[model samples]
Target: MCEIGGGMNFKRREFLRIVIDAIDGKTESIVVAHKDRLCRFAFDLVETLVNRSGCQIIVANQSKNAPQQELVEDMLAIIHCFSCRIYGSRHYAKEKVKAKRKYC
Candidate 1:
């Protein structure tokens, strides 16, 4: 089986390193637990890898030859990141309100 790492866990540089190392060997594929694990920058990553390494990425949770995987993954990543940002903003707003009430 191909070695796997997550973008959520590893920084983009680390993810790229892992991918490059995997491609340097006789590995036929790089397996990710999910599509987003491969990259939040899915299109660019795929294009670069396909051009440079010629190794395919297999998202273990995805079906073979899924045509929309890249687009779907990118959209999902955007949504997830946006949600986190919004949640953080809301949390900070709530904390600010509580602090103002306690002090003023």
Candidate 2:
């Protein structure tokens, strides 16, 4: 089933209820636009259900269809964050030392 992820009134209750019904043998197939669309990082549980209960998952957007540019951009953003963390800490320490010392 298709559903919107986030908004001021975002609700995940329907998703949970669907899962419960699937567990109870009411539904066998689940189709989603993307795994991340349902939740940012919580597909393990659904995979576990597939393993245990033999329910099939059909993802509309396969990995091969995903944009390469988005992956590269995400990687660049992560690198930028880590570089800032490392250099920002060093800069803070240097400034702190400069404040304490009159001359070097």
Candidate 3:
């Protein structure tokens, strides 16, 4: 199990690519500091790897075959969705502010 990224350094797309490549026989399981470090994509990626690559992931903090996988995936997805909504709202607010300032 190779840890892919630090908390600040990790990006979702890179993580996905790493997992996909690992499943494609390029590497083994990806390791990370925590379950959330792998983010919302873990559930789908795990299923893909299992179906397509015969690969299994090893989350260093969690045991292999841990029952918590499903729960963790759900939590991560919720957090990601919430963050996206917050970010979208912030962007919308910023745009509105800019337009108001320009028009006024």
Winner on lDDT between 1 and 3 is 1
lDDT (10s digit) by residue, model 3, range 56-81? 65557864645687678566767876
lDDT of each: 0.65, 0.65, 0.64
Cα deviation at 91, candidate 1, in Å, is 1.2
What is the overall TM-score of model 3 with all chains considered together?
0.52
For candidate 2, the C-alpha RMSD (Å) to the true structure equals: 9.6
Which whole-number lDDT from 0 to 100 does residue 74 have in model 3? 64
lDDT of 2 by residue, 20-86 (tens): 7777777788787766555443466665775466577677986654578657755675676578779
Q: Can you list the residue pairs that collide in candidate 2?
A: none
Report how far residue 65 has shifted in candidate 1, in Å: 4.5
Model 2, position 64, has a per-residue lDDT of 59
lDDT of 2: 0.65
* CA RMSD of each candidate after superposition: 5.5, 9.6, 5.7
| Two-way TM-score contest, 1 vs 3, winner | 3
Per-residue alpha-carbon lDDT of candidate 1 for residues 1-104, written as tens digits (9 for 90 to 100): 34344345445565656666756754566667766556645445563664476667666786464669756865786788788889999999999999999999
The lowest-lDDT stretch of 10 consecutive residues in candidate 1 is 1-10
CA RMSD (A), model 1: 5.5
lDDT of 1: 0.65
Clashing pairs in 3: none
